[model samples]
Target chain A: MSNIALRKIFAMLVEKLARLEIFLEDKKETYDRPNLKFVISCEESLKEIKQDLLTIYPVLAKTFEGKVVSAEETQKALEVYKKCLDKFLELHSLSSHLPLNPIASETYIFLSDVLKIKKTFKEFDSRIVLLTQDFLTRNTHQCYTNLPFVSDIEKKPMALYLPIIENSNPLYWPILVKNIFGNIDSLKASAKKHYEELIGQKASLGQEKRKILEKIALQLTYDIYSMKLLGPAYYYLFVEAGVFRSIAETRIRYQPTLAAREQILFSELERQNFAAIAESTHKWFITLSELSDEMHSTLGFKVDFSDVQPAMDEIVARLTREAESVIPEKYLFKCSDFCVSLAGFERLKKGILVASSTIEELNKSKKQCKEALCEVNFTEKTEKLQELPNTPQQIINAGWIYSEYVYDDLLREVLKSPQLDYTPFIKHIKNNDTLLLNSVEKSRIFEILMKKEG
Target chain B: MLLNKKHIMERLVHADPDKKIFITPFINPEEQVGSVSIDLRLGTDFEIVKGFDSSSKPDFNVSAEKLEQMAVKKKVTVSADPAEPFYIQPGAFVIGYSIEHLKLPSDLLAKIAGRNSWGKIGLFVNSTAGLITPDFSGTLTFGLKNMSPEALPLYPGVRIAQIYFHQTRNSGSVKTEDAGAGTCEVISGNIEC
Candidate 1:
């Protein structure tokens, strides 16, 4: 299939996703608490929905994966996925009020992702972007984190773990994208200003430099996130995650200093953060109780979270204007006018009542009611949320779901686009094991990649 | 001999902690157990073979490059909805977790099998590190691949696989080596060996 034909299919799909994202963001005049009984009764319907999606997935993947897909086939393929959305939306309408991300959000996320990826492809079709896994793994200052990054591994092939939450959740996609792009841009600056100082960018001896870099990293993460394009859920997720990371209960791991003290370590502990997990169904609803209270305390008039679009608009309108002189001209962070937020314990109880059958399961869990789950499995897929609040408002009452399709789409697009070239940089550096070699080895590699003078 | 539904339930509802076959959220306990096995739903967390983002692409090739170290530098674990599954593209192998956390007693060992229904569609489910041993803890990881020529949508909670229990005859309990090959803790951001 020509990229053009595939792109056409994606374009139509994006249009469909935009409509759904809008629908999800649109708060109902009055919300119906999500009921598990409905999901139980509708189990067959859900299976049928999966069947319907299966019809589309293979055809859709084929069109993108080198198979011939005509205009008609593409449309038929798209119709299949769209058909599932309508069915899910009908089911999701009642539960949209709950903190759970509507199942329909998956399609919306793919649209946002493809559009963003398409934009990047346009900017650097043949550019020398950082070979991430390779760069980090090969850099003497930092080699443990990426194995495949080293293109010439003669040893047995190894599998790399790409967490779907970090990869696909549209909430994290913007920062995920920017961090890669932004870090490279930052590395270029660091290479020049501080004589290419990235070995310990986060852990440098000079606290001042480390602080500035950390602040810059955080600011860039927040700025690069397209609030307008991704929507308020991601923004709330971003804020909630930031707040969660600040609290101590999480037991986020801290790595001790490296012997050379040459580079800063970006541990997995950071991403396992509250901001990321808060997006999980179980955590979001519970976290909303406090988050809403915080917003009520700070924003004053916006109590109850009956509607947040207007307030969000006012804040963005004011901030974007004030920060206009600073933010990049081409990129603007925006949010949908979709209004949804903060359904309380009362609504939660009402939601649970619908699933009368789940009372047995909730009753089974009563012994552990007081203990809120400390470590929520990223997907909330753990059969027994051992530590989660074992109230009537458990899995059935609270929605437990997030997107999984976006990453597949992203992976497919990346594999097809192009194999990045690094022969020039590789040829310049002579030695492979450079730990014994001096700090000069680090500069040589970056200098060649950046085309800098020694 | 394989434990039947009646025997399986006995271990499941067993009062003694040492005798219990601990599986969480058994859901409809009656429905999950089959004549000789119990169904395991797909979990939300997954680890795909793909590496992290492109920007972190390192510039050099290596003979001693440890894939685990490289993976850590990149943020790349995935969580998906049961409805919107990660398509296990034909020929692509992925590690999927069972929604049920299993902790078998020393007397019981479990074997994972691809549901006959999924097998008809060319999905073969197996564990890389082999049969789940007694005393094994943590969510079970299934090696899912589409044997068919096309990409197949894999949803979480679709009882894609089934696991049957076996009672060990030996009095001496074998040390349960994790049936996973360095798969766990990918969520905690650390890849455990």
Candidate 2:
């Protein structure tokens, strides 16, 4: 393969590497996970690959005037790129969820993130194949450039130059005289060797073949060929080489920048992780709601607030721990806020329990108060009646003074006589006990009857 | 055979979209779907059998109207909405419903039983009527009896029972007939009461 062909392939590989790196950068910026070690590993490899592409750019561009560059080194660089791509694919496949096609099952909505990442990988793989084909077949049909010479003082051509090798400094001829004067035969032999090395053919005396060999020798910076300066041929080669050199240098410089543009992490896995955490969080909330109901139901009003305190504490602690474990650190604050609200729910539940106890106590106290009030009313009425006079005669006098309705008209008549004769009324009193009487009246009547009998 | 988790998941995945076999107001599938059964939760509404005059015999044999009069329907809220819970006071019996409404396919016949965890605490959960009929779509009502020495307080949304599904021989044809029959629309017709 020609040096230009190798350079073209190298450029294509660099483009793929840069794209992969960009994808990683985007992934790192957004969806990077602390849990999946492979993601971080793939990212690290991408960074190294980017550096490798930058280092190899100038090396692959260094096809001199006549000498051909071997495809061996470029193939090795391509291998590195391919390996990186393989790593990316492996990471993607390992992380992707089971494909839904074979199962013919409707996936849970939460699995959308996984499907997205799988799509990314699928697209990445297809692009890689297309790029690889472009890399392998590019610059194969045409001779892209003739090598340019380094010019110096007096506007004279000074020495032949080659672009920088990947891991080495740039190469150029300091003097063209030594090869012309000594070992000119050996220099031709060396040019013939390079022709065979690049084109896989022996050099011949035919004009076209000789011209190609001379050009190859000049590109290799063979001292004899540089010294000779064969008239129109050298000038034609130099002019041709100048156009290619300008184009190659410009291309090499621009290539890295293009690759740099696409460099950043693009990770769907992180989005998937976020979706998973959200799904789990949703489920946790539902379970917690159910558990809260059960706890409230089981111990509810019957158990004191203190009885449920530990259980509430346990649930809160468990939820926090679970959130911490599953939820990314970036989302911890939101989860904590939710947990704090859950604690608030427990506090509200506690208030309800305490209120239930308070109401029960209030009801019991109300019942006792009602019974005590009934007893107090009975005692007050009794004490008021006991305030009557001790002597039966005085009691009778008080009753006659305060009397509104007479027990009978006969009793009223007896009382009207100021209790002078009660004998007649006593027999009537014995017969008619149904007549109403105050305590004072009854005492007085009994005393009057006793006196009369005596 | 009693359906296991694998079979259950398969059915869930492939079940008809319109006639999806499901539990509504869905909780966690991991927690609800057990090896043999699905755990069901207690609902808010309850019908408590108030102590009646056992000494005097009534002339009318107990009718629907009498049953309605005999039982007190109470809805219990767990939070501060109500101060008192529906307490199944020691030696008391109450009826409660499941929070989730179930839709079973014709191929399955399910048996509802009280969870052992609650049963150990002397809470017996049973249906007054026997096994759940296929093609049934309603919240199951359970007769809850607290045989414990202490008053057992039941708040809404607790796991009181589990329904284990068993494969029935005449499931497909029976389900089609039942769904098309539309006899279940009658409130009294569907309810076991």
Candidate 3:
């Protein structure tokens, strides 16, 4: 095929990426995208790009398909984006503006950050897709590639685990990149090349296993792509997913001979780890909120001095009426008394390299906290280790599912009804539990609790 | 008195914290505001009864302790994913929770039922008595017994049930944990005591 489908998809991909570009209005982006034709048609005829696009199109489509973009196009766009950028860079001067699409800004940062290349573009009209997604894709077309619980739980471990710990991470670039480039810098020049390399490598696994592995690899990429729209709450859910590296005892061995009976359970340590992680997330959030409360009381139109300090406890319902402030992780608890001096507030804000929970992050993430709080993990350990069938996606999911049971029944004690106060109900619930109430439920609770203020 | 939409909205955001009705994921307030009854999404969890031995059958003569132990092993919980739904065959009964987590203030009470449209589809979300008392907080669970001959899909996340809220006289009864969580776990589909 002439890659006609791939070209059509990428052409449409511009519209989807543009949505995310809208998020980066921060850098004062005035440069408009060139025509779609100019963007995709420039190198449409390249024979080598066709194979890669065809394979990757479907994957991208699962994540990026919108009114202008189709899932098929998204998959292709994802696989083809880097290569297209490589070609674009090869053809143009370093300073030439990206002639591609609106997501050029995001892709620029995403590509550079993932490849470990340190390049900053201050004037570029760049946007990382600002819309927070469910870290797992429920907003887009649902695609479950034969993984257990893929329909409900997050699709990949790597995406789930890294969002939070990495959120406040020193290399905030990975979280900012949104897309999971996943150490892909050295895989190969292109997807087609990767396929060739895959076929050639691990020859001892046999041709059948190798082919299955390649299929799994491609599917995994789309799964990660699905999480590209992750917001801050997505990061905090690393422990909520209850699976992955933290669960040290989790053993998910490959089951080639048996059906999909993968035996996995959470040990005592994993549960403790979950509790520790949950407490950390809760502490980080409450401290952030306290800082928000402090910011609200200190700045802006406030004309009073005396009661405004003590009255803040009465007025700021989780700082919904007024809020903004984040401190580095080390100093998260320092502002325990949110009634800080403006100097102290600035001091807290300046120490933010370790603090990932900003006002924006808290707002986006709090939506999930309620749901996390309300959820009941009826997680029961299996009586015996059962062997599940060995599928490639199973292997990929097993990467985390072994650890998946990590979040079992831990948050059951946390009450659902928030202590009704001047604060909104959701904040009280967050104060109440570490398990979660889904975002919709949490927001609903927020509305319900806020009713008292009215 | 049965609270109308206006009263409901007022109570929803009542100035007094004790008088509000909290039906969350109250997804579309404007849409929900149009009617007196709040449409509730089906919750994620459903429990299917595993065939138990004759000894496992409930009898009034049996002690509550044995019944409690048997209840745990006699049923399997299935979490329905929005991507793929769980199918309930004809004449089958499954216990399910409303996706909308509700927490009524001390002064309010609620009644839950299968939505008329869902009732037509042979899915009965009727509670044992349909009455939820004051100060309840948790997903409302109800018995969803399929009366249709064909297997009916129990899709979570849709408006499967509708809840009507009411104002109580002399309210302020303290809540017992999950006093109105809407199910008797030991009794399976039995009404809460």
Candidate 4:
């Protein structure tokens, strides 16, 4: 048998399998027990296809045996062989449509062996599909059908389908079928649960009204930033807070009836709900703090009250000073004595004065200080500077100055160096890190640098 | 348009003998004629060089010489070899430079086409090759990508792609710069240049 003969046979087998697939798809609805019948027909067709394919295998072997050719001819032969192999594998895949049995396993092993040959073209898709089917079948018996509190689990197609889909390789048709079945089951369960909850409590509510409330609840629960439960509590707090202030402002006019008063009292009960939500927020914050602490410990940073306390104090003082400056004159007059009684007025004034200076002047001073510190090295000046409390505001100010320095100095150098390729660096920075830059600020800096270089 | 093997060989030989055109039937050329196109193969040598800055001049002669040396030695140790050369697997499409220095006549244009065999393996010659000017010189640089899932290893001197030449209406007496004849003209006024 010649290679040409084998290829013809392979093409014929593929055509036959394609026809069978179409027939199965069309007849699926007519058969009451389609699975059993489908399996039987598929098995018979697969056996015939396999026998036909095996006969062609000898023909392909004969054509390729001890053939010497020019480089160009070898290349063409490889391509032809690959095409034939792909068609052969496609025909072989009909076995998978049958029951998960010894035949399927044997077919997979035979295909894997055929793939190891130095053929130019191998059919990857057919192998991927067969592997996926085998994986699903192996895990199907382990699938759970009796989940707790979920009545009629067998009726829910998802319970039957999920294990197959999740366990199977994603490439297979069965996995796609399983996924669709599972999604339908999940949607049905969710809709049923929603209906039951809404119907029992809000019998007077229309479907649209219930739907709106449900949507609001879902939105609150799923917000990534606010962790799950805080959403509902925040919603209630917002509603109650607005009503509470309104009621406080307009008392009897708003409270028309005794029933309205009772309603207000019941809504007030949601204050406890708000507190629980706040507690959750606090817990989240605590978790964040713990993670930071672990990071610091791992990085071998010293943990002391003195190391962090002064920074906290300076931040509080800066915030207080800003608040005082923003207050209206009339409001200040009312609280003048209270403000005067507070400590650190002189320190606040000094900070305000330093912060008010032009960036150039401040930068000059900072540079001078840094130079002096470096020169003094082990001197008392360095120790004194270190002893000074570093506030969040000061840290933030330093960060802003550092970024400006980099933009003006380093980035300008980059722009001037035409031979330097900054693309990879830019790509890395853009993909991997978030720079603390406002769009306007970044654009302004970039524009200035580009103009100077251009 | 439906020229047989004999005519194709004659036309190609007469077309540009100095241009080193080789035709592989069924191999999709950069541009397909009636039924066949010549496949372009990867040249033995490639140079990955640092691009010039705004102030720097692009000297192709220097780069080409360096590429030749690298190819001869089979090793490059100077200032990070610019061109990284790799073999295109049997069914794979790898980027390579053309061996021929194609200089299209003023009234002629050329388009690169992938071979049919390559196209069958899902190897598509990208639309990088464009109108070859009348007085262009130097090898055409090709950027190849394999659309197939499997690796297609390509070798040097294999017909990997082809160029389809077309004759344009004669527009007489145009300056070289205006006609965009040379490498300098292509790079000039371009952003990267």
Docking class of 2: incorrect
TM-score of chain A, every prediction, order shown:
0.24, 0.19, 0.21, 0.17
Span of 10 residues, lowest total lDDT, candidate 3 chain B:
B182-191
lDDT of each: 0.39, 0.37, 0.36, 0.33
Which residue ranges in model 1 land beyond 4 Å of their true spot? A1-454, B50-83, B173-193
Model 1, range A1-454, lDDT digits (tens) per residue? 2433334333323333333333333433235444444444345455666466445555556756677776566556535644654464455434422212222222222223223232112222112122222322232111111112224523221112124323333223333333333344443443233322332433424544444343333332332232332333433333333332222112222211111010111111122232222233233333333432332333232212113223323332333343333334433321101110111112122221111112323333222221132222122323331211111111111211211112234435433423312122122111110110111111112122122211
Say which candidate scores most in TM-score.
3
lDDT-best of 2 and 4 = 2
Candidate 4, residue A389: the lDDT equals 16
Error of 2 at A230 (Å): 90
Provide the TM-score for each candidate, comma-separated.
0.30, 0.26, 0.35, 0.20
Q: Who is ahead in DockQ, 3 or 4?
A: 3
Could you give the CAPRI-style class of model 3?
Answer: incorrect
The backbone clash count of each candidate, in order, is: 42, 20, 38, 33
What local lDDT score does residue A318 receive in model 4, on the 0 to 100 scale?
35
Top model by lDDT, which number? 1
**Best-to-worst ranking by TM-score:** 3, 1, 2, 4
lDDT of 2 by residue, A1-454 (tens): 4443343333333333433443444455655465346457665665665555554444443542335544565455445534543443344344321111111011111122222222112212322222222221121111122222122212212222112211111001111121121233454455455444543433333544344333433333321122122211121223222322222333322111111111100011122132221332232223222322222333231112232223323332332243244333432223222222222222122111100111122233233334332221211221111111123111112222111112223332432343223343444322221111212222222222223334
DockQ for every model comes to 0.01, 0.01, 0.02, 0.01
True contacts kept of each: 0.00, 0.00, 0.04, 0.00
